[model samples]
Target: MCLGDISARSQDQMILNLQGCDIPIHESQDFKDFSEIGTGGYASVYTAHWKITKTKLAIKQFFESSTKEIKEIIINEIHLMEIMRKKVIFHPNIIKFYGITKLKDEINYAMILEYADGGTLGKYLRDNAESFKWENQLKFANDIASAILWLHDNDIIHRDLHPNNILIHQHSIKLADFGCNASSIQLEILKGTREMPVSATNRIFVNLYKECWEHEPEERPDIDQVILRLNSIPKSHFDSKENEESEIIDELDLSDCDVQLYY
Candidate 1:
């Protein structure tokens, strides 16, 4: 079947259960309060507190007025998350998925997720430019590579793997904002503006970066190979005094890199 035919079939199979059985509809009282944290083309993210459990959570809300096409895309995204939740199991580098909620007579539907207190990796890199040493960059890159390897082993392609979609929590990296089908190489190109730290110019790091951005998808190294290469790099390279004091490039322009969720 053509790609369009496959997509059409997938959308046709998506059925939303309004009865709070599979995915519950949480009442407003369940959450103490919600504050907007971020916004994408199809949904808005809010940080909410669970009244009884006293747990902090991230909720992505999708409006009801969205077109059928957009709703299908959202459903596909949710389906992909569910697949990962069941198949890949849990990994430290993968974002945790809670559940979905839809209120009665409300146009808003929400998907509850784990809240990363430290925010996106892109933001962390920018804010800590002075302190983002080579050692830390290597750690973050390894975390991301491990997560991608897990996803690929489960037969799922992230399709969107940029710094902005990589969240930081407790100084660790977690991959997020994926599901739609796209070119992996193209996604890397989209991340060019984020650029590697000056310290990453080491021969080993340079080779891995080039392999990741290879134009031919098949020519690109698998996440496992990428991880192996990253692990092979000498720790001393990152420990050099020059790398420690290297100035960070503060020219990241994210305006053009605003990737829409489920696009």
Candidate 2:
């Protein structure tokens, strides 16, 4: 169904909920200076300037070919964003969702998101591999861990997690691309029965990575434990001015924290 042609009741409810969550609905004219940045199976991403806020933003526009499927995906993502907004789970490492826009004479709505100047984390690592120090690598790991912790705590699983899905902006991590493939069963079973392989040589985070990649999900460490281990990395590995400055992990008290999984 076209976003603009939804049933009156559904449209009204959506508009009311969006207003309650402070998510603005705008027209295509609200943005300018569009440049196609990326393309995916269902949508094309563009860098545009939001005329209202004067901010550089990424606009994800779904294609019209698969209208029904694409519409559901868009609604699901927006609903997840609404939940994040309501629960106040806005973390520095998570990509920010601003609002949505309907293009002129178009059937689909576009998502307005934070623009990442540094591009995907995969590209960033490849470009700076030689110059990237352990301190910097640990920082990225901690950032990803923190975001994953928050996401898991809030019952959201980024099913399509990968280096490309994890973006980098201004030298920081921004978790992105929460697609519509939510597993019906909470338990995600790995295909193989073999134990997760670890590197031969000893490295500071090798064990941590191994624990996280355990064959059984139950055998893996929780995000909180992963974060605690990550926090120890900088303190245990290096004692330089740069490491001290690059350390971004905060003292988080998780004693009373509760993890709730929404089905």
Candidate 3:
């Protein structure tokens, strides 16, 4: 077969795979007022107003001059988003993927996503460091865990999970930036060994964190189990703990942990 034939077959297979997925193909001209918001290693995101719906949306456009390897990564992420959409139509804590649009005079495609009004979690936390309370911290942790559970339930692993990747929509968390990474290493747990301040409820949380950081991947608790553990920590526990003098938050300080990331 000629190269043209192979390319045609590959396109056919992609269409077949996308059949019944119900994801829309949007036209680049349908959006206007594009303003760049964020940029990553592979793609740059823009805020655009959709002409059809008259709604503001985020347009994540992959770099146009990307190599074949980078293009493949972009395509893989599209497929991953499609798969997650197929499994769950809407997830409260996860970012919503609307459709795709090809930029004018460009071969690469851009993804239409819901706009997060409050920006990234990292920036939000930094801005509100002074007034951030225990209750707000609890809610953020729960929201993140809930989003991770949804991903795992749909057989998708969010390999790039961090505060900057997590966005704030209104006052809630929206998990984003799903990337490709399969290898894993153990993260050090700083519950028992560290001399950080801890309450009864916090001790339970620390134990759960330790379980999640188990050296053996199989021994680690899944996201679902992690959620259950979080829920099990009674509100009363936090109330009692907060009633006392507030030294610091109960979360494990990553700076104290010896976590080494490769690539």
Candidate 4:
């Protein structure tokens, strides 16, 4: 992300062509020709620029053989986004979806969202860990909590909430990738202990689906409760090292998940 020498040189280029761009999205298109920003079991994210607005956007492309199900999910997500986007909202920790590419095919589907320049929080933490102050970390934790609360207020559960999905922009936060987002009532996890501990040190992916992977769906905490847990995340509760690029690699290997760390 260091544009230093390049800032001196003239590298007028990027993954997606901004001067002229196009989309013929279908349920079948493979969404090729670009570096994948992120790849999960069902989808991959790409870096894109909106020609109309000339703004940076993160395009998450989902591949599905089931045409009906794909379209249904796409439509539902679009509707949910439309409702949530009605208000002008901004946060330092949550990703925001702009709009969606007009659905053309069943296999080709993508969501357009604001670009998270600093990349994933994991990457940011690593890049600045050497000198980042405690105040910055505290602000981040608080910002994320607020965003989760906002989503809950709207009756949506970011079932896949985690650090890698979170983005930072000039110290602001934006949560990204809502492919797994859903609207559902929540219960609780009898952790034997009083409540589920909101731990930031936990690796991102491992924590996002904490309750979903659990045998009992009832044990999953609802969005509101999730908000409380996030809000309760006291910065002073724990101390952490300045995240390093090395740590990012180690954690990814431990999680055994293939994902891009955009530090």
Candidate 5:
């Protein structure tokens, strides 16, 4: 996946459906007239409407390239979403998926998602940078923590949980993107009257990032654990050298959002 190969790969994504797969394709009726909302390292976001449902949706269209392993990743993502659709289960601060596209070998993959009105937390922070203080930061962290905890409690690891991954809608906080979801972290289970400790399983994520990016995936922090860490840091947290604004923003702490599993 050299830079030059991107163009050719992106063309496949322009396909509305994969033929012969009997995949249900919902091409944006106004595809040619939709608004480009944003772009990511590998995808483009658009605001589109579903004619049958007459509902608004956010479309994340990925660029084409055989190098990215997420094709299977996206396929698995859809399956995981289908299974975990209710995992969030009545939580007001999480985003919901509407549907998914069929898999393909020669085209860009797309996922239909529930659109957020307030935009990414990063963008909002920048826009209101001067006004964001400990009050807003703490509130945002609490809301996001609740959503993340819900995901972890359900046994799903959202490998990417940075500020950019957060979608805010008025008062609600929605966590988006699950391309790197890992296995569930079940509670210590009872097996034949014997108890086993998977404490390392809980620490798997930390292994992914204990030292700078210790990135020892095996040691990454789970949601329940993250809740404890976030709570331990006081709401008035501030590093004198970092400045008041920087300190507050710094404390919301997406510093360890990116984690990898260790061997």
Candidate 6:
């Protein structure tokens, strides 16, 4: 089947599962002070404070009385998050999934997730395009590649691998939004924004991007091969010094530095 058809099938299955399943929904009283931070076609994300844990979190709230397509998408996303949680494969480059919540009177469902202070990589690059260093860009690419490799290793394909789905947290890349089952080749070309300067990006990244968006799915390298290629790139100054204990300590101390990139 074509990518669009595959996605349609998946959505149909998800809708059926959602309608038939009796999934328990937790009370939304645990979260407070929800402030809208971001939004997508399916849901709106809010930064909320978890009353129980006293920690900040991102709550993705699905629209009330949404259409079947949007409901299917939300259910699929919840299903994917449940899988990740059950597997216990908590890779650093992947966003941390918490749990789901549903208010008693509201028709909308909410998903609790790790709050990414740095926001999406696409926004970060747009805001800091002029001053963002090449080395950091490479690091972000490596981190994203590693995350993708982990997902593939676990038999999950990130069919929607775009900059908006890639988040920045603690100055590191964390891949997000893996609910859709569309072909990667079909969606690869739609990964970045139009304003992004493709020519200005590192040559290695440019080549990798081209390879990823190839028309033939079989011709594209698997995630492991992609990781190998990213690893082969020359180490940055910080990476080179990581071998020294003192330098490692310094790096740990500087972990909170504001240089953040995504995707």
RMSD in angstroms, all models?
5.6, 9.4, 6.6, 12.7, 11.3, 9.1
Q: Model 4, 184: alpha-carbon shift in Å?
A: 18
The lDDT of each candidate is 0.68, 0.66, 0.66, 0.52, 0.55, 0.64
Candidate 2, residues 192-244, lDDT tens digits: the string is 43333332212557677777777878999998998987887655464434333
TM-score of each: 0.79, 0.74, 0.75, 0.55, 0.59, 0.73
Residue 263, model 4: Cα distance from true site in angstroms? 14
- Across 2-113, the per-residue lDDT of candidate 3 in tens digits comes to 1011123333122213444456778899999998876766678889998877899999887755555555666667767766665635688888788788878765567888
Error of 6 at 78 (Å): 0.7
In model 2, the runs with Cα more than 4 Å from the true position are 1-23, 67-70, 181-189, 193-202, 234-263
Candidate with top lDDT is 1
User: Model 1 misses residue 153 by how many Å?
Assistant: 1.3
66-86: candidate 5 lDDT, tens digit per residue: 234555455555555555654
- Angstrom error of the Cα, residue 67, model 1: value is 3.0
In Å, residue 156's CA in model 3 sits off its true spot by: 1.3
Q: lDDT tens digits, residues 1-263, model 4?
A: 11111121223211122122222222213223345666654556777555545566667665653244444454455555555666576443555655445334433446766677787776665566456565565577667767877877667766665556677887877776554543222333234322233334444323544653555667776556655665565555445555542343334322311255531
The prediction achieving the highest TM-score against the true structure is 1
Ten residues in a row with the worst lDDT in model 4?
Answer: 1-10
Q: Give the TM-score ranking, best first.
A: 1, 3, 2, 6, 5, 4
Residue 41's C-alpha lDDT in candidate 3?
62
Model 5, C-alpha of 203: deviation from truth (Å): 24
Q: Against the hidden true structure, what lDDT does model 2 obtain? A: 0.66
1-263 per-residue lDDT for model 1 (tens digits)? 01121233343232364543344346766886788877776678888898889899888887655556666667766766766665545888888777667544555467778888888876776668677777888898899888888888888777766666788889999887764643345556565533443443556777777777666689888777888888988887776454344443354444434543311
CA lDDT for candidate 4: 0.52
Clashes of each: 0, 0, 0, 18, 27, 0
